[model samples]
Target chain A: MSEVYAARRERLRERCAASGSATALVSRPANVRYLAGAAPRGAVLLLGRGTDLMVCAGPLGAHPDDDRPDEALRIQTLPGAADGRGDPAVAAADLAVADGAESLAVEEHHLTVARHRAIRSVTPRLRLTDLGGAVEQLRVIKDEEEISCLRIGAEIADQALSELLESILVGRTERHLALELERRLVDHGADGPAFATSVGTGPNSGRRGHRPTDRRVEEGDFLSVCLGATYRGYRCEIGRTFVIGTSPADWQIELYDLVFAAQRAGREALIPGAEYRDVDRAARQVLDSAGYGHGLSPLTGHGVGLEIDEDPQLAPAAMGKLDTCVPVTVEPGVHLPGRGGVRIDDTLVVRPEADGGPELLTITTKELLAL
Target chain B: MSEVYAARRERLRERCAASGSATALVSRPANVRYLAGAAPRGAVLLLGRGTDLMVCAGPLGAHPDDDRPDEALRIQTLPGAADGRGDPAVAAADLAVADGAESLAVEEHHLTVARHRAIRSVTPRLRLTDLGGAVEQLRVIKDEEEISCLRIGAEIADQALSELLESILVGRTERHLALELERRLVDHGADGPAFATSVGTGPNSGRRGHRPTDRRVEEGDFLSVCLGATYRGYRCEIGRTFVIGTSPADWQIELYDLVFAAQRAGREALIPGAEYRDVDRAARQVLDSAGYGHGLSPLTGHGVGLEIDEDPQLAPAAMGKLDTCVPVTVEPGVHLPGRGGVRIDDTLVVRPEADGGPELLTITTKELLAL
Candidate 1:
């Protein structure tokens, strides 16, 4: 694992060298974690020129030695770290200047203008270049270890959802159900929820990213839940909509079938060489022709890993093609204003045609389930 | 309430005008919320040049109407909002340009370099000026209404913590306890926890922002728990340390008293006209004299409101002063590396001596309990 992180840093270093940067500072947490193995609170990764350094303000967040960075990376806790006052990015810049580096590349997309100005003020003589989405691009494809973590996270999410289905759900508030799902996710060995658990019932169902409310579930109401787990550092998402009564109504079944088909289309389109937009269109078109075009979310689904939303967004405007080992979510839904709707989502890894195709990670059933 | 939001926006608009800007864009969520009752997901508040607009990507997060922005602020959901595709800030900048504004002030501290660059690209003719924490400065002194929310939130937190103390805690893991406390916070009507709940046991106790571990509670161990609740967008924090089982070691009692005294000093120093650093020094000097000076967190406490950690940081180097209605936490602790330590924290609102000194919001007992 240490070697893996070191190699990752080495690759980034090579990229920086080719880009005319003497050093590179990764201020983005996920990018730092990708190259350093673990990112402590306010930690930043400095790559290039001398020895690689992971400068942290203090100890790691919540979990300590359990998520230690690569052994190969030199951990530099800022002086007076007891107060946790230092910005690791500025410290990295100071180290760069002290090491006599000429230029440093930084993530312009991540660092705020104020922090960027502070960094420049710290190293007035050094030329700071834009690292852009270099690390994000590097993280698009994953190794087996990364995929395994995502798989575990998906399994945890599935377990949490499965447990929710077994027990009584009607008459329960959306907020309570969301909280229960989150607790279950943690119980099943997740660091925490990949994101806030979304539970919508009745009128709120099928709404994308709907915040759980105190609205209680009632008979004949559609219950839509979107949840994910963070295993180790990787994240995966799974969403399912079920009816609250003994049997789903005609509209509920029809809506569920439409959304399930759209989701399946998006999932099936996740081939290694599939264009990101093409995959989105595969799912989007299913609902578009059915007169539900105006009610769709921007994207059909999005890539997930370290962060729940990553690169290779499966949206109409998204560019680039899928690559093997690239994990993404294929979610599609349609919501009516007054009445409820349906959404079926799944996380899958893009695989080649010869290797069976896209590997579905979130294996929760899409078939309409009635509580 | 709508008038209150309008007045806040007017104040900010005047500040921007005084700074020689035609319009101001608030991209920071808290600042937006402060000015516009509720800030929807990916929303930005554009003040001045014309009617204030709260441009949002889509609907409000989770709860819609319950947390809607001020009615006076016109909300413009982006054209393709169904997919949540638009960046509200960029749309805001475009609005500024369309409104014939010659200069636009933006929160440079909140906007990323890439985002700032994108805004410049969109409106090259418009002079882009740095707003630079103008809204945050305005938010420093809370209104009676804002303080009321904080008071309610504090009550919720105190209730949650008090409930946790009554439950049997021995043999329970720090993570489970932390989760349980969070659930209780929600059960007691908190929108959610203000921040991640911190539960430390044994050697982990007394550490600032300690992440809960699987370590179980045992006899003769020091236990520190820090939790907060978010109610009506206001947040409050409270932390207390207790000795596990029916007895405590001499070192534990001694450390707990020291932290308690330091915390009290800090709370007492929260007068309306006191310097922020002086309030910190009040708590810090106590621990400093006890040979635990070097191990203190950057600040003895910090102001809390819409965000858990806000401005008016009570740190040694922080430049600010306590003002009436400003809510802050006075937390102080000492940690023994191998053995458990103690931390005591409370949230209080600064008031004039005439108003009966500092108004403590968290009313939980500070005395060490052997639970």
Candidate 2:
């Protein structure tokens, strides 16, 4: 495990050196956690000229969840950072200059302008360069170990959703149901919900990222739920739409079938070397041809990993190809204002056609069940 | 309500004019919400030459929680922003240039370097100035309505904590307890938990902002829980520690008593016009004199409002004076590594001596109850 982190840092260092930077500062929490085994709050990883250092505001040991740094790497705690005076990134840049590094690469997208200015003021001679999304790019493809975490997270989410299906959902407020799903996820051994559990009912159904409200579940209404779980830092997402009555309305059935077919098309497009946009179009065209494309969500799906949302977005304008071992969600939905809609989503890993194709991690049936 | 937002924007406009920036762009969500009465995701407020405008990625009405913009303000949605191509801040800057504003002020502390650069590239002639923490300063003193929201949120938190005290808790894990508390808060009509609820047991007890873990309660362990609720966009915090068994160990009783005294002193120091550092010192001195100051947390407390952690942090090096109606938490805790510790926190509003002193919002007793 320690060697895995060290190898990742070495890869980042080689990339920085290739880009003419002798040092790279990783302040983004996820990126820091990727290079170093752990990322304590306000902690930054500085790949210096001679050695890599994890600069933290306080002792990392105090945080139980933050993974300890690889023994090969050094840890430095600023004297007053615990009192909020010290910034780990600035301290890392100062260390980079002290180590005789001429150029430092930082994630300009993550660090605020003021923090960047502070870094420049502290090291006037050191040239600052943009690290950009190099770490995020590296995180796109996952090893089997990473996939295992996602699989477990998906299982936890599936279990939670299954339990919710068995309970009496009618008359329950969207807020309570969402909370119950989250609790069940934790009960089934998840760190927490990957993101907020979205439970949209009635007119709120099929809305992407809809926050749970006090609206109660009612007969003949569309009930859509989108939730995920985080297990050991890896996140997986799953969404399904169901009917709340004994028999669904004609529009509800039609919308559910259309969304299910679209989601299936999107999921089936998850082959290695497929263009991200093509995969999105596979699902999008189904909905577009059905005349529900005007207010469709931006993307059919997106890559997921340590972060709930990551790289390789499946959208019309997205510029990337799916690779083997990349985990992504294939969610497609259509919502009509004042009426409900449907969305079916799943997390799967891309694989070569010869190898059994995509491995579906979230296996909850999307049959539009009527309770 | 709309007039209040317009008045807040007017005050910001006056400040920007005084600072020589003809136009101000507010991108920080809380500041935008404060000035515009709504802050949809990826939205930026531009106090343009002609009128203040909110630029968002999607229709603001689609989001249920986002407050409607003041009727006097205009709203513009970029064509491709919903699909992730457009950035509201950059578009606002471009609009500022088009509106004939020679100079623009932005929240440099909130904007990323890449974003600031993009804004500059799009509007090369516009002189970009730092808005600094001007909006945050304006938000430091809450109006009566804002204070009322915090008061209600505190009452909800107290209700949730009281309910938890009556439940069986001999062997429950920290995570379950935290989740239960959050569910209860929502049951009591909170929009949601202000922040992640913290529940630490035994050795994990009394750590500030400690993430709940799988550790279960034991016979003589110290249990500490910290939670808050957000009501109508206002947030408040409360924390308390209790003994697990019928009788606490001699050391546990002594430590709990000392922490209670320190917390009481901190609460007593929340009078109007008090220096922020003095409030922190009042709490620190109690624990410091008892030889437990070596590993104390950075700050004694901090202000809470729209965001859980906001302005007016009460720390040793903090420079500010508390004003009337400023809601803050005086949370002082001591963690003794393997032995566990105690923390007592409450949200209170500062008031003049003539007005009967500070108003305590979280009314849960400080007494150490053996559950």
Candidate 3:
């Protein structure tokens, strides 16, 4: 694991050196974790031009039970960070200057303008440059270990969703169900829910990123839930819609089938070399032709890994192409104003045709179920 | 409530006008919520030089059940935010330019360098100026309505903590305890947790911001838990320490008593004109006299409002004086290297001596209980 993290840091160093920066700072939590194996809250990774270091705001190994920062890197702690006055990024910049680095690259998208100015003031002689999304691009293709973590996370999410299906859901509010699913995820060995669990009932169903409300599930209503689990820091998502009662209304069944088909098309299009927008189109065109395109969500799905949402976005106007081992989600849905809606989503890894195509990580049955 | 939000926005506008800016953009979610009533996720508030607007990425009234964006303010939605493609800040900047504003003030501490640059590029002729902590400073003093919400949030948090104390704890893990506490917070009608619940046992006990783990309660363990509830967006925090078994060891009792005294001293120092550092010193000196000050957290207490941690931080180096109606948490703790430790935290509001001194929002008993 340490070697893997070291290799990642080495690659980042090469990118920085090529861009005329011998050293780089990673303040984004996910980016720091990707190169440092683990990052304590408020920790930053200062890479190259010195001993690779993970500078933490608090004590080293704050969560020692699960924290396993790369053994190959040294750790430094700011004296008063836990009190909220210390900033690891500024301290890391000072360290960069002490290491004799002439220039340092940083993630301009992550650091606030105030922090950037402070860093500049702390190390006025050290030239600062934008590292852009270099680390994010490097993370697009996952190693086998990373994929295994995502696979486990997906399995946990599937177990949690399936268990919710077997239980009595009617009369229970969306907020309660969301909380139950989160507890189940943890019981199944997940670090936590990858994101806030969304359980929408009736009119609220099928809305993307819908925050769970107190509206209780009722008979003849559509219930949509989107949840994920984080296993070993890898996140995977699965969303499904179901009928509240035994028999679904005609409109509910129709909407569910349409969303299911669209989601399937998006998943099936997750082949290596496929353009991101093409995959989005595969799912989007299904809904567009069906006349439900007016309020369709922006993207069919998005890449999921260390962060629930990542690069290789399967959206219209997206420029990137998918690659093998890149895990992404395929979610598509539509909602009627006063009625309900349906959303079917799954996590899958892009794979070559020789490897039997995209590997589905979340195997929860998407068939519209009447519970 | 709408009038309250309108007045807050007017005050911010006056500040911006005095700073040579005709308009201001608030991107920080809490600050936006403070000025715009209820801001949607990824929403920004554009104030002055035109009609006050809350520019959101999603649909209008996404969470109509509880969302109450100021009725006096206009709501605008970016067409592609739910698809994860829209940036409310950039759109707000464009609106500022369209409003004929020659200069705009933005929260530089919250906006990323990339985003700040994007806003600059979008409206090059519109001079961008730093709003700094103008909004945060405005938020330090609470109105009667704001204090009422915080009072309710503190009550909910206290109920949750007391309920947990009555449950069987010998075999429970810290993670389970944390989850149960959060569930209770929601059950009691909280919007959600103010922050991540922290439950630490044995060697992990009393560490500020300790992430829960799977360690089960042991007979002689010192168990510490810190949790908060969010009621209508007002956040309040409470923390307590207990011995897992029927009787505590001498060291556990001593440490618990010391922390309790420290917390009490800090809480008692919350006067209308008290210097922030004086409150911190009132707590720090107790721990320092007992030789436990070496690793004490930087700030003994800090102001709380829409955001859990806010301005007027009660720290040694914090520059400010406490004003009446400013709610803050006085949390003091000690983390022993190998054994365990103790922390006692409570939320209180500063008041004049004529008004019965400080108002204790969290009335949970600070006694060290043996569960």
Candidate DockQ scores, in order: 0.65, 0.75, 0.74
Report clash pairs, candidate 2: none
Model 2, span A134-165: residue lDDT tens? 99999999989899999999999999999999
What ranking emerges by DockQ with the best candidate at the front?
2, 3, 1
lDDT of 2 by residue, B1-371 (tens): 88898889889989988989979999999988888876788899999657889998877656455467777889898986777797999999998888888999999999999999999998899999999999999999999999999999999999999999999998999999999999999999999999999999999998888888888998998999999999988899999999998998899889989999999899899988899999999999999999998989889999999998988999999998999999999999999987788999999999988999899999999888998
Measured with C-alpha atoms, the lDDT of residue A15 in candidate 1 is 86
Pick by lDDT: which candidate is best?
Answer: 2
lDDT on C-alpha atoms for all candidate structures:
0.88, 0.91, 0.90
Q: Output DockQ, candidate 2.
A: 0.75
Score residue B367 of candidate 3 by CA lDDT. Answer: 74
Residue runs of model 3 more than 4 Å from their true location after superposition: A84-86, B81-86
The model with the greater TM-score, 1 or 3, is 3
Candidate 3, lDDT over the whole model: 0.90
Worst-scoring 10-residue span by lDDT in model 3 chain A: A59-68
DockQ of 3: 0.74
Candidate that beats the other on TM-score, 2 or 3, i.e. the better one = 2
Q: For candidate 3, what TM-score does chain B get against the true chain B?
A: 0.97
Candidate 2 chain B, poorest ten consecutive residues by summed lDDT: B59-68
**Residue range A28-111, candidate 1, lDDT tens digits:** 999999998887767898886879998988755443535788888888887765453567888899998899898999999999
For model 1, the DockQ equals 0.65
